[model samples]
Target chain A: MIVGVMGPEGSYSEKAAKLWMQKYSMSGSELRYFADIEDAFLATVQGKSDISIIPIENSIEGSVGVTLDLLLENEAKIVGEIVVRIEHCLLSKGGPEKVRVILSHPQGLAQCRHFLKKHFPDAELRSTGSTSHAARLAGEFEEMAAIASPEAAECYGLKVLLSNIQDKKENYTRFIVLKAGKKTLTEPETGSEKCSSSACKTSLIVYLEKDRPGALYEILGTFAKRKINLTKIESRPSKKELGDYYFYIDFEGHDSDALVKDALKDIKAKTDTLKILGSYPAFKTFRSVNIDKGY
Target chain B: MIVGVMGPEGSYSEKAAKLWMQKYSMSGSELRYFADIEDAFLATVQGKSDISIIPIENSIEGSVGVTLDLLLENEAKIVGEIVVRIEHCLLSKGGPEKVRVILSHPQGLAQCRHFLKKHFPDAELRSTGSTSHAARLAGEFEEMAAIASPEAAECYGLKVLLSNIQDKKENYTRFIVLKAGKKTLTEPETGSEKCSSSACKTSLIVYLEKDRPGALYEILGTFAKRKINLTKIESRPSKKELGDYYFYIDFEGHDSDALVKDALKDIKAKTDTLKILGSYPAFKTFRSVNIDKGY
Candidate 1:
């Protein structure tokens, strides 16, 4: 199996890919790194990779708009999800006092804003393509530092100047694994023996029939009536005009379930466009395992 | 009156401030520029500025998460809103061929990605604090170009090498004017003459009583039952836990309306926390005005 991810080799995305591999027991799978999220998705669609792992949302920063946008436009299905705790480390070749420049991805820099402001107030902060790219650059310069993962420091042969430098200790990023093939969805099964063995999540995008008053209320009513718990809901521009939006919603339950099918049917009747992005098992949070511990 | 905005002078916020000044006939009001969005909001809260105009959402990019986060935490109320068309221009001191580096705010650069890739693929792309700041730096060097508003070119004494270079031509950003004082909301008036003179929008954040199934359904039911039109609905992590979220919803009709008042009363009964962010007149779309034309 081949897994695609955004990278400079040792990015958080690469870490996520590793975590996902361990969770699914897909050891010995070849990992391919793409330039960006879109390219990773494209690789899966073009059959260059079996699966593409992409970040969907961050605990502090919220959703990744580009990934969401690509999901809406692409021909891939979300098959699984994994949440990775983001622990940023300040890496440098020299001591903290000698560091005059700080670098990381824009998000990495933003995550450690308070730490940087208090310690390296005079450091020139710069954004690179990835944290690992910053780590590689920091390794070459004695006066430079990078905000990245501890794994990145090991990868780039840089010493950890500071560990867990992010503002929030519980920061996490949820990544969805996407595959090219679509699952076969049937008319929801109605039975006392509910297909609830695995906690399932159905993600879909809905466009209202018209920009009318109470349109969304009526659409959301379908899921509300079915008592389906919504995990997430967000509005994105329809790209047609101002005020017009397409709602991306994630609700609990599989598409094969009775209530979800009924809800989606009712929702489709009211919406001009209704695209079921995917159905996947909801992610369960677990304590971070030491990656350095050999499995 | 003094208006606070994100600085470097010739930014889209300043342009929106000007439009707002015209809309309210508040010309001759002093415009104060702040370093960031949070600072602009702080200025309003501190009485340094009477009102602060900040971008809330872009048609293409979705909501500004930081602005939304600030609104949730701050004491200010949204008084009004204005939508400005985002027309990016490539500005430089010399011709396009002489440009070796491009600079702009991250969003500005992302918006003009296609134009940059097609024309100046080899140019180094750098992110700055503001587009006008980039324009200022671009003006100082013959080999530097900035993606900014045409107004920035005029402000920084640079030439517009290309106009309307954004990936999406219909791009528009909605800016909300926030004031320090909160409005006292009352029950919707029971009168034959409804206060439907202007299209109004009510923004609020709701935290459910518990993370229960159909908790959101019941919340939406209040609005659905009243036939209230929801313009937008989004969930942001409560920063407490991964699954815990606060729903930020925007719906039509002022808080003064009878149905809206009834809905809120019911919603408050069911919710643990209900905050009425503010009610403001909905922005109307209009053709882009020539900022260069004399007022």
Candidate 2:
């Protein structure tokens, strides 16, 4: 199967996509790169890519709203998940002192803002297409430095001026693998029952009953009553009128579990629109680190 | 009161600060411009500014996570709130037969991404410090246009290629006014008893009880049972450890109100920590319009 990913080449999304291929143990998997996440989604939707991997959220950065919005807009189902540890570094050509401008992705820039303010407050912080691009530029220009990955510095032949520059040490990003067709895993096999997703968690996109006040309370109450643990819950504008929203929720158990099955029944009763994005295993856990080291 | 805002001058934040000053009918309010929201917060904390205004969330874009993170980091109280309408424009140097690049702030660039991709499929989308900065560059350079405010276009002497170019027409941004100290306005000689905010609102930061199952459920149950309507609820990283969080909540009715007072008392009983921010009247309904129309 061909896995579509976002890139300027060697971006975090691309790295996450590669890790996903390895985790699935898919041999000889073809890779396709798109300019942005939307392009990757379109490739999957058009059957150009069998599975598409995209970053959905980060621990330090919060939700990737555009990715969530696209998942809701496109009818694609999330068939799997992956989480990758993020490591940032400062790369420069003529060393740190010679650097007049620092470049990185907007999120990368924000993550390193404190470090930059403390060290190089007067230096201009420019936004680039990706961390990889920033590293590439840092390597090419004498008066520029970039906040990126150590791998990126090596790839671009730049000196690593500082390592682990992120504001938070346990920086991790959650990515989803989307497919156009119906999910392959069914029933109990969707959870740990199957070797494919034995350690995986499940995510759901649900819309609640609008006319009833406390309908959302009742819907969340179902999960609470069931003792089901939720990892995340984010609300997005459903493009409907004001006060209407689509709630995207991530939980520990798969749909086939008795508790989840019962919660779905009560949730369906209170929901106006409910769609299952997919049921996949959670990504591998990354160990936490020092926030100061990340920058 | 001295108000701190994020701007180079004539930015959206400056406009919002002016509106806040007028609402309080406080004349000759000093406005201090900062590089970003965090800097403004620091200014307030250091007694350089009495109040700081910053955009916290956008309807189309969801949460501004950095602002939320900064709020959690600094010991500042959220004193008031406002929602400003956002209207974006496309400006250019008059003779652009071939537009190679379009520039905007990262947030603005993200907001208009779909439009840019559809219209200029091959053109590069660049990021700048702000919309006003983009317009200034576009005015000085020949091969560029900018996505910014119409007033920005006028101020920088750029031609308006398009107006209201944003994908969504109903785009609105919710801004939070923060301060180091909490102050309350009660019905007094200058105000009438019929004032809407005499029975004000209260914002709080609460940490959930323990890892016990259904703990948050029980806490939310109290609000539901008491018929308290929640205006907003968001989770931010506690940073003490991975997976721990603090919930920021906003609801109608002051803490002194019978129902709300009971709700707070119950919430505190169940949660690990509860800190009240402040309560004030919402923004006066204001209609914003295009620059040529003098809104």
Residue-by-residue lDDT tens digits, candidate 1, B74-164: 7878777788888889999999889998888766776675677678766766656667878888988999998989989999999999888
Question: Against the hidden reference, what TM-scores do the models get?
Answer: 0.89, 0.88
Chain B TM-score, one value per candidate, order as shown: 0.88, 0.83
- Cα lDDT tens digits, model 1, A129-194, are 568878988988899899998988999899998888887777887888888755446533221123
**Real contacts retained, model 2:** 0.20
Candidate 1 positional error at B146, Å? 2.3
Stretches of candidate 1 above 4 Å error? Answer: A94-102, A113-125, A140-144, A181-198, A285-295, B94-100, B113-124, B187-198, B285-295
Candidate 2, CAPRI quality class derived from DockQ: acceptable
| Top-lDDT candidate index | 1
Candidate 2 off by > 4 Å: A182-200, A208-212, A239-244, A284-295, B94-98, B121-129, B182-199, B209-211, B240-243, B284-295
Best-matching candidate per DockQ: 1
Scored against the true structure, residue A66 in model 2 reaches a CA lDDT of 78
